[model samples]
Target: MTAIHDVAIIGGGLVGASLAIALEGSGLDVAMVEAAPAGAMPAVFDERNLSFAEATVNALAALGVMQRLRAPTGAIVRIHASRRGDFGRVLLEAAEHGREAFGQVVVARDFGEALEARLSGVAGLVRHRGTRFTGFGAVGDGCRVLELAGEGPPRMRARLVVAADGATSGVRDALGIGASRHDYGQVLMVARLRAARAPDGTAYERLGDDGPTALLPRGDRAWGLVHGVAAADAEAVKALDETGFLARVQDAFGWRVGRLLSVGPRSAYPAVAVRAAALAATRAVLVGNAAQSIHPVGAQGFNLGLRDALTLAGLLVACARRGGDPGEASLLSAYVARREEDRRRTLEFSDGLARITANPGHAASLLRSAGLVALAALPSLRAGLVGGAMGYRGDVPDACRSGAAR
Candidate 1:
């Protein structure tokens, strides 16, 4: 633990932890720094309901992350999408596409527990729990010195540095990698509720002038509700009582799944799209939310970040096997090159979907209806959306592809 490790990863959230798990037996000296105390799960943060794509499920299953979950997972066998006051709609069934299921949904707390269990098996790895990464500076010997505070040593040197600290990443800023952000003027309100009619493994999306209100099935026989409202109405909506809130949701979502019976606590998140100006600089690179954060309308945020982690881990392991320097410019450049298409398409998909639905102009409205009609009337037109939804966008990592023999 005293010697310089090959890589030092900052921010041990799902993405960072996933990268560490992937690099477990790669013969690369790895260390993880997490700000939270060991076994301390943030209640508000843990209340999230994550929508895992099919490809993401494949990768996690291969990594043994999914098998470690103690809770049952909800499956997605069909998707129903429509707009209020619109004539066209889309209904996609997984069976028609030659797949048994699109993906699964799990509570954030459950997923974290699973990751924690698997991380313990990495042989001879270094763990820096409850540690804060102050910043990093070049060591002038092809390595970077990461300053830290907490139980670990004050400083550690590594050839490769990773910033998975999230959207407002101090590590990314320290590396001089700038980011551009677009505020969508929307807030997503999430909650867990029970429907009078039990879920039948179908996810629903109700599009509106501002955003989409989505309902995802959960293993506990409850539905995860993600409601989008204009920024001006966020506070008013948040102040509603349980009964009022349920009424509002029923009004927006219609009676597709039946009346909402009860709702747990609710949380609100501002929908913003963040993109880094550059992916890699010097010996460091960004992954997950630190690299890019998009609207949750498409459920592509975490799935996209997972792919980023898998790609970087796969490359590093291969390079280590060949005795190549993990921090070399060539390796980092290659990592960025490998991720470009996926990043671009995902950004386009997440951002464009929201803008298209939000635009009030007649032309945009017509275009939206036509697109939905095409998706409903022609099966071939649904392939693109289905592929993106199933996490098969661009330049997917071998570990993330369906039926990949990893």
Candidate 2:
């Protein structure tokens, strides 16, 4: 007899792995499937920087994932936002919000390693590395038969399937979940940078004629550069010598962080906004980039996805404790209801920021400048923005709120 897992998660990336860890000791049999081999990092985890909101950090701490991290992370004490040719600039400080830090930045590779290390210790969790999720078929009222690429019976059963397979999710495709995509006509080039002065725990977001450029603090004098260029100009930007590229970045971002001394390996990806028409279908649900991939304007992508994973984990734990089916229609409905507001607000905020900052019209620029000034001058506006950026919107999951895995 094939052992049925209470939950089988596709795509063992950050979100999926985090979900498995969150459900540790929840009395549910969980399986995590990944195309990558065990202990191997994916391409997306190569040298990329991830910004985690305070709420996300708290949730990770609750799940014991934070304690497993061996790499040094950077703190974001303040966020400075400005645009070229704009009169006003806004600064959001953690001190004003009575927090030590608003967020933290971690290299993706380090995070992946941490997750991989911790996955082995989770009780009742099975990790199927190098396994692919082929598709699934309805088995019964609250179960789905999952097909794998490899040997064995070629199929297994699961009460719930969570798709965390990223933006181009095969599981989502097999399930016929449609996504709406919008290309921003921009490509973001990322690299490690060394500055003349230390970062001082501040992250910078600078908007220019081309697009937005973000400098996230990495270490004492190191930063992670996310420089956006026109899609047509990406090749030219990438073709530039290190010195030339640094010069272009400095020109766009100004001397906010002082002189850019050096740059490391470069990676570029086109910015696309992808949002699924629905988050849940049948016995399967989508999380992370699989459900909605948005522009990284406000650094909301992974943070939002982390919330999704935590929420689902909470719901699954509740269902298990009550002896209810994980894939029951009521459970799925409740999951959707809990997630709708946060997802909509995050997508709107990220998409709106990307669009408004990219607009070069005089009126738009003027309005943006005024808005920044208002954000700086108005305590209510500043508080709202800070709260949202800290991941304190909509329903707060128990796992994240209580910092407990229960």
Candidate 3:
């Protein structure tokens, strides 16, 4: 006989873990299956800092993760975007947004550890940390059997399956859902570095012919730099010695934050825009990077993923309380509807921005440069762009609006 759970979450990354925490005390049995080793914690720094806009900050605070982050992480009080050789720019100040700061910047590890610590207190949650999903099949109405490695035969069963398994989700593939993926022909270099100038809670973005470079504030002492470069140059940048790497970064980034003193080991990832064709099926759903992996050009990947988790959690918790099947088609359809705007708009924005900013032709360059200048000059246009940065009017999850219910 298979032990049953209310929900089986495949993937114990940030989004999956957070959703499990959110479902605590809701009378639902939750289990998270991770492909990694047991109790494996995420790294402290991944060369990319999580940039949380105000909306995301609120969403995190609501989920109770932000309060646990404490200090040593940084807040972004201002965001500046501009194009080189283009006489245009857009600025988003926290004051203008009527918030304390546009968002908070936290090291990926800080975010993960804080969340893991919180999960300890949430009752009725089981984490299958080291076990991975070998396969899954529909067993009966409202239940599915899951097979895991190094464990007894296919023992875990659940009414609903949530695949937060990430961009290359095996569960998604096993479900036989297809996706649309685009390789941007560019690579993103991410690093954490010590800077000569204090960041002062400011985030900077400069779009050049090579690519867009984003410098996000990290605490008061460090900074997170993301440099997007042509694919041909990616290996060279990643291969550079520390000194050579810093020089390349300094050259591409200029002295916006003064000189970069020291950089941590560098990491590089091929940039791509990916989207799962369907967010849900009859008895399962995909959230976070499992649904889509947008370019990291704007640090919107995780935030958007959080929204997916948030929305799905809310839908499940509410329905479960009302004696409804959390994974029923009705519930899943509602989730898909709620997330459409967010997924569509964000994908478009990230893809479009990357395409234009990376354009090398004189004509394309002229058009983008002029557009940037025009965006800076028009107050309405600037605010619109800034609002998007602050996380407004996209497909937001209901849990993002409501605190994780007790």
Candidate 4:
């Protein structure tokens, strides 16, 4: 007989793994469906640097994932924002907000390793690694039969299914859920760069004609470089030698982080904004990139997705406590309602930033400079911006509020 799980999460990437960790010891039988093999890292977790919001850091700590990390993390004590050829700049400090740090940066591989380590110790959690979610069928009231493509049992019943399968989610497609996609006509090339000066917990974002270039501090006195290039220029940019690339980056970013010493392996991907038509349907719901994939202008993608996982976990725990069906329409409705504000606000913020800064006109540049000045000069505006950056703009979840997992 196929074992039934209280909740089966599709996609074991950051968001999906996070959801699994958040629900630990919640008295609900949970299963994670992953296409990758156990202990193997996904391509998404290689070399890329992830910036965690303060709320996300707390949530990860509460889930016990932070303690398991083997790689060193860089704290973001301040943010320096500027526009190329603009006189005005904005500096946001954690100290001003009475916080130790606005966020922390971690290499994706390190975080993946931490999540894998924590997953091994979670009791009552089943991991179906190397298994792909093919589709699903209505089994009975408050449950659905999940079909899999792998060596194990082909089908299992799940009371609730959470889709965290990323932007191109198969489960979402199978469900006939439509997504609106907007291509930004830009590609972001990412690499690890060494700088002359040691990192002092400062992150930099420079806006120019090409696009926004971000330098996020990492361990080992290096920085994670995200250089956005126009679609037509992506190939030429990739073809540049290390020295040429460094020169181009220096020209775009100015002398913010001292001299660039060296660069590691590089990877590039096209940027697109995708949002699902609906967040929930029947016994399944979308979370993270599966529900919406926003541009990484403000580094809000994963932070927002982590919030999704945390909020859903809280709702599931509450449902389990009350002996209510996990897949009940009421539960899904409540989950959507709770998350609506945060999701909308984050999507708008990220999309707006991407659009406004991409324009190269003098008027646009002046507007950008004025906005930065406002953020630095106006206490009310600064507070609201900092609050959103720290991931504190929406309904707070218990899992994120507690210092440690219950």
Candidate 5:
């Protein structure tokens, strides 16, 4: 017999875990499937940080995770963007945007711990860590029957199966949703290092002909560096000794952050923008990186994913309150419609910025520089850009505004 659930989330990473917490008291049986073993889950090796937009912070606060996060976090009060060897520059100041800070930064471990802790006490939630979803079948009333290799033939059923499994989602593949994939042929080298000069809560983005280098403030005399490098050189860079890697990074970043003293082991991520054909189908939906994975130029990936999760959760809860099946066509369509504009605009903005900045010729550089200058000089234009960066988009759910997961 199939043990039914209102929602069966196919990934238990940050997004999946947060979704579980959001639907806790809404009278829905929620279950999360994490592929890796409970003990083998990914952990932060070093000082990995995530920039949470103002709306995202408020959303997480509303979900009850922000209050649980400890101190030592950094808030991004200003963001600086400019192209190397060009006079084009744009700065986003929180005061100009009428925000205390564009967003707050938290270490990956801190955010993960807070999410896991809050999920622990959510009633009617089942977390199947160390389990993978082998297959699923369309069943009665638009519900799906999920197959797993755990305890028994529990045959879990769900009105909506959210595939938050990530960029390479098996659940998404099984659902026959094809994505438009653009492999930028670049790898993002991310690391933590001590800076010779202290960061005054300012994030710096230097656009290089090859790729972009971003320095995000992390308190305690450290900063997070995300450097984009050619795919062919990714392995070589990662294999380089500390001194060699820092030398390469310094060449790209220049003296923006004073100097790079020491760097921890670096992590690399391939850059790509994937847009699924559809976010919702008959009985299943996708969110987070599984739904749309964009380049990390603006740190828009996770923030966008969180917003998707929030919208889907809110729609589900609203449907449940109205005695409607969350997986029904009307419910699913509503979610897809709500998220369409934001997803399109974000993907375009990230992709366009990456392409424009990557052109090696002088003409492209001039155009981009002029655009930046124009954006910086105009108040309304600057406001629009900052709003987009701060996670404001179409039809945001109330939860996002408060940073609440629930």
Candidate 6:
């Protein structure tokens, strides 16, 4: 007899692994199909620093993911945002919100390792490493059958198939869903640096005419930087020697972090925004980068994706408790309705911020100045920004909530 699972998760990247872990204790039988080989980091888990929102950190902690991280994570106690060549600026401190820190920071590589360790201990969760999901073969008998290649079953059956496969999701494509894409014409460079000044639990984001340069704190008193450059200039910038590259970073970010004495290997990422036309199709649903891929402007990409995974997990687990089918049309519709608000607001904010800051025109300059001034002066406005940044926008999941999760 061909074995059937309650859920077959496609991709097994950060978001896919997260969904499996989130379903750890649920009665559902879960299987994760991943393309990466055993003991290899997933392609997405590169040497990039990720800024986790407070809610995201809380949720990961609840999932027992944080405790497994071997690398030391850094806390974000404050944030300073400003525009270059402008007098106005906005500052937010965690203390004002009665919190110890706004969130945390982790290297993507370390996070992948931590999640792998956590997954190893998840009871009854099946992992198919180095596997490929070919396409959906059929949907019948209250389940969908997946045609796959590699180590897993050639054919697998599941009540639900979650497309956590990332932006270029084959599952979503197979489902006949379309995605709208926007190219920002910019490339973001990331690297670690030793600064003359210690980070001191603060993160700095300096908006420039060309792009934004952000400095995030690290546990070793160093700094992690994400600097934006024009797409045409990326190669020229990448060709520079260590000293020359350090000079470029120092110029873009100023002396706020003092001298950038040394830098590690650098990676460049092109900024492209993608939004799926729909969140669910047939008995399948999309999560993480599969559903939406936004700019790294506010460092909200992963945070938003995590929320999508958690929200869906909560709904599916509830259905399991009721002995209900995991992939019913009505249930999938409810997931769409539940996620629409937060997803819309996050995409708008990320896209709008990226566009608004990329322009060097007088109008954009004025708007930037006005925004910083309002944030500095109005508590309500500052509160709103912090609330969103902390991942409290709408329909937050149980694990992401405060108190117990905290």
For model 4, give the RMSD to the true fold. Answer: 1.3
Model 3 lDDT per residue over 1-406, tens place:
6778889999878889888877876788888886665567744224467888767777777777787885577888888887776666777677865667878888787787778778778877887766778777666866877777754334588888999988888889988899999998888788788888978888998887767888888984788888878898887778889888888878877898888899887778888877999998768899998999998777788888888888888888889889998778899899999999988888888888888887778888778878877876787887787777767756665545543523
Query: What is the TM-score of each predicted model, taking all chains together?
Result: 0.97, 0.97, 0.94, 0.97, 0.95, 0.98
Off by over 4 Å in 6: 403-406
Which pairs clash in model 4? none
Model 4, 1-406: lDDT tens per residue? Answer: 8779999999999999999988887899999899898667766788888999888888899888988888789999999988888778889999999999999999999999998888888898888888898888666856889999885569889999899999999988987899999999999999999888778999999987667899998875789999999999999999999999999899888887789888898999898999999999888899999999999989999999999998899999999999989999999999999999999999999999899888888898788888878877899998999999989877867666556754
Top candidate (TM-score): 6
- Of 1 and 6, which scores higher on lDDT? 6
Provide the overall lDDT of each model, using Cα atoms, as 2-decimal numbers: 0.89, 0.88, 0.80, 0.89, 0.83, 0.90
Q: Write the per-residue lDDT of candidate 1 for residues 112-219, one digit (tens) a residue.
A: 888888888878679888888998756667788898899778888989989998999899889888999999999988999898898889999898876889999899
Q: Mark the regions of model 2 whose C-alpha exceeds 4 Å error after superposition.
A: 151-153, 402-406
**For every candidate structure, what is the RMSD over all alpha carbons to the true structure, in angstroms?**
1.6, 1.5, 2.1, 1.3, 1.9, 1.2
Judged by TM-score relative to the true structure, which candidate is superior, 4 or 6?
6
Please provide, for model 5 over 275-382, each residue's C-alpha lDDT reduced to its tens digit, 9 standing for 90 to 100. 898897678999998999898888888889988898889888888899888788887888889999889899889999898888888898778878988988899998
Candidate 3, residue 118: Cα displacement in angstroms equals: 0.7
When summed lDDT is taken over every stretch of 10 residues in candidate 6, the lowest stretch is: 397-406
Residue 255 displacement in candidate 6 (angstroms): 0.6
Q: How well does model 2 score by local distance difference test?
A: 0.88
Error of 1 at 269 (Å): 1.0
CA displacement after TM-score superposition, residue 353 of candidate 2 (Å): 0.4
